[model samples]
Target: MSGHIAQDWEPVVIRKKGVAAGQRRDEKAVNEARRSGGPIETIKKFNAGSNKAATSTPGINTKKLDDETEELAHERVPTDLKKNIIQARTEKKLTQAQLAQLINEKPQVIQEYESGKAIPNQQIISKLERALGAKLRNKK
Candidate 1:
């Protein structure tokens, strides 16, 4: 009896320069576009157009806004409201995943609301109420 091992151990050829150069160019273009607050498509087009890196992407403003004039908007959803949402969803015998599908939202969104990690906007709240057949909003 003869024991024979079958194996194909061929050394792989690595062509780094071509692939690496392309990836580097793409990364550089994307970074430039992001820093300038320009659309990513602009980077793609710029890269497709020429080998030179663009100093500025036209039709994009790179000005910084003052914090005093910029108001950070946040919706205040009461903890009771979060409880209401969870209660209603449970009463309907629906999982957060199911509720998300019925309401056309991601499951993570439902989970976030239930866990009090997020306050959904008015539009989403309305959808949730309809799906769970419960009133989530407080009468004000």
Candidate 2:
């Protein structure tokens, strides 16, 4: 039985189509074109008609520009609000860090508010007003 089993068992060699011998046909063409300095067409082309002409120019009416500037001004903490905050905080004898702690905010937030760079937040402003005992909004 052992001699019969030895005769039946044989080594099998499995060969897989080894990685397509080298560079693929299309890749080789691209590489050759690069080496030869031939102009290869781009995959995407700019549509000349799709681009819109510049609407706003120096000679154009600036009402729209003024409206945009006003909108940007409204988005940030007002300069007067910042000044009021600084004055109130100073009058209360509190440092920026101390005022921030009192209002449950970070010192950087207080710094941003004082510098008029803070995005106006009603909740934070309310907290600041309460902490400083001052009105901080809509003061001309």
Whose TM-score is greatest here?
A: 2
Q: List the residue pairs that clash in candidate 1.
A: none
lDDT of 1: 0.80
Model 1 poorest 10 in a row by lDDT: 58-67
Give the Cα error of residue 102 in candidate 1, in Å: 0.3
Lowest lDDT 10-mer window, candidate 2?
Answer: 51-60
Task: List where candidate 1 sits over 4 angstroms from the true fold.
Answer: 1-73
Q: Where in model 2 is the C-alpha error above 4 Å?
A: 1-74
lDDT tens digits by residue: candidate 2, 7-109: 5778999999664644334667768878989865535545656643555355456766665654334578888889999999999999999999999999999
Best candidate, lDDT: 2
Per-residue lDDT of 17 in model 2: 65
